[model samples]
Target: MGKKGILLVNLGTPDSPEVSDVRRYLDEFLMDERVIDINAFQRTLLVKGIIVPFRSPKTSKLYKEIWDENGSPLLYFSKIQAAMVQEKLGDEYQVELAMRYQNPSIASGLDRLKAGLVESIQVIPLFPQYASASTGSVIQKVMELVGKWQTVPPISFINSFHDNELMIDTFAENAQKYQPESYDQILFSFHGLPERQLKKCDHTGQHCLKKDDCCSTLTDVNKFCYSAQCHDTARLIAKKLNIPAEKYSVCFQSRLGKEPWVQPYTSDVLKALAEKGKKRLLVFCPAFVADCLETLYEVSVEYHEEFRALGGEEVQLVASLNDDPKFIDALVAMVKN
Candidate 1:
């Protein structure tokens, strides 16, 4: 009877777009067993010796391109989202924002809720699709911290909202509003994860389908399968918009390292579309509900240029859900449920 709290979680960003800041952030992010999922020694070497040292400078440069007056897009938008959700939820539920990594950590968010003497807490991870690296890590971290608490409050974790009716409606409505003209091709590009990491959760093969029936069919496993859920979201959104199946393609982007991640890579698909004579393309990045480096820089700018260079024209990148009223309404419905 004290208070009810809501913790809004998102994948974090570096404190600054400098190499040093990026390295530090990567050290914490990649060190997560859920993120890299390797043994300690191997994880340390891979993250520090290889990834942090090399990828940091490059990623920092990319961050610089997207850095705003406020700060990194992820942090800025997350703060806004937290404030908005708090305002919407009103005094009944104390809302706090936490980044899975970096400042305003999940532990701190939980601590704030505890300080408020909250009776129940809803932990909503701001990911449209579930990934062991993203949603799983948030869940693991929250459970780890809450486990050490003397009196744990009732908690509910909203894993993914891929097929939420409101979510689909929001995305469909946005697409309609932005690109009213019929698009020759619709591309749904999601953030990529290594295939090995995905197979790790393929227990019973019922949910996974291991490249066969897994994602193609909807089952309990598809609920947790990042690839499957992303595609399903695209399909559902397309259905809502009455888009033809053949006119759309689902692909993955922002792959790091040499390891094979999800396939039909976005770049390759773009080239293929250009060669296949699909001139006008409309792209969507549903993986990220908000516009970040991946959506803004990688897809909108980079891929837009790529398509043009390859003889395509009018490559329009649809905006992310980012605090859209419908999206906000969806979040409210999700939490209330």
Candidate 2:
């Protein structure tokens, strides 16, 4: 056996908080057919004319707020993860990090791996749960690129690791510092996907959004459903934390556009918790493996203020698995497995 290459992928971020960079990153990301899931002309119009133009400046400002001295947390941590995984794997495996969008792209990562002439490649999209806009997109892009190679080495894509014990344990461990029992309620908030996307993944056609508890239980039919997987991930973490079913809520956040997204929305849940006199809340975003704009700015900063306005005392966001040693070990286990 020869050297095996490992490409760790995460959702991309802008090269900088600058408006132009953000607009460009958004353009590449939203333009993906799997992401927007619309016709070419309509997608182009929406991304360029309306979405990017309107969202870039505002998003750029938010990025500026979350930007660290090292830069985008997602990218920064991803690079560290790649280096760490490489070190753990030793010289037998060459590891590289790439973002599904923007700089340090899949193309560059693949190029480096190809130069090594590795015997095989394992592509790990950092999303814990499978989503068409995320892990699916990464897989699609990788296949499209590697297909053009004359002799593509044996390639494998780890689609979803939502059920990984170490991954779940990592999140649970992060919440331990907050003293889980102290919070009024614990909220497992995964990044939201469109309802249509969830339903589309239901091959049985009978499952997904058809019943109230459709997502609460994972089934063969709903195994690939993003919402179902998210709920299951939450259940595992909650179980580890010894959080009773009634004391925890599984919700989705970062919804975009006017069309219905996966419910119940985290924003709505937060308000409802406040109305119900649940003063303190602890939020866990298991969907994301690393802290990015969604976890940092949207959840910690934005949701904190929103919860405060709703009479909620505190909205504490559990830290993400960003370059944590245990998380790196989890990644190593996944790769070795």
Candidate 3:
């Protein structure tokens, strides 16, 4: 018998805040078919020819703002998480950390595990809610690499842990520090997805955007739906905190292009709340387990500025569950059983 191999993967970050490095990272990330969902030629034309070229310089600046002596927050926290998980799991488990894109590639992580001669490999993508562009891409890429191995071991994947009790509690627990009641409006802002993507997840041709209840309720027909899972996550957290259903709003953020993304965008919601005289706002980005550019820069800085310009007083972002002991305990339990 050999040690169990645990591969922990996060979204990823650029090697540095430099424009060149950011460009490379963007090219690799946006070029993913799952991400753009366009033909290869078209995606290449858009990502390489336009998006990466124009966006990289501006995006690098944002990365620089969040970048510290520890470098990228995502990778830094990911390293800490891997170490903690390894320490907790003990010698019986060989844990490796990788990013779905960029440095510490999945190939290197899997190679180390393969060298360790582990009996089985457990893959846990650090995305609370499942989405095709994220967890699905990681799974697909892992399979594409491992399929070529001559001596492949038993492999397992944690598909989605959005409704995990401890995970939900962790977010609620973090918000407790912020005093949720003090805020005028609470926003559970998740990363946005294209409307077409949600439609693709819909097994039934008519079940997607046609129905309104699907977003609030999780059913087998739309169980794999990303929007539904995000809403369910918010619901669980709100329930745990004894928050009223009408008190907080669920919105999506970080959308690209002009296509209609998941509705009630965070920007629009913030603007509306500002106009409604809801000055103090609290935001929870549960989709992200670790504090990254999205949570730190986008939600904290950008959204705060935007809201203030709209006559809002504050846009306080609740901290993420980075290296939290409770989260690690839940992770270990997932791996063991």
Against the reference, the lDDT scores of all candidates come to: 0.86, 0.92, 0.93
* Backbone atom clashes (below 3 Å) for every candidate: 1, 0, 0
Q: Write the per-residue lDDT of candidate 2 for residues 260-302, one digit (tens) a residue.
A: 9999999999989999999999999999988999999999999
Q: Please give the TM-score that candidate 3 achieves against the real structure.
A: 0.99
Ranking by lDDT: 3, 2, 1
All candidates: TM-score: 0.95, 0.99, 0.99
Model 3 CA deviation exceeding 4 Å by range: none
**Each candidate: RMSD:** 1.6, 0.8, 0.7
lDDT of 1: 0.86
Residue pairs of candidate 2 with colliding backbone atoms: none
Query: How many Å off is the CA of 262 in candidate 3?
Result: 0.8
Predicted model with the maximum lDDT: 3
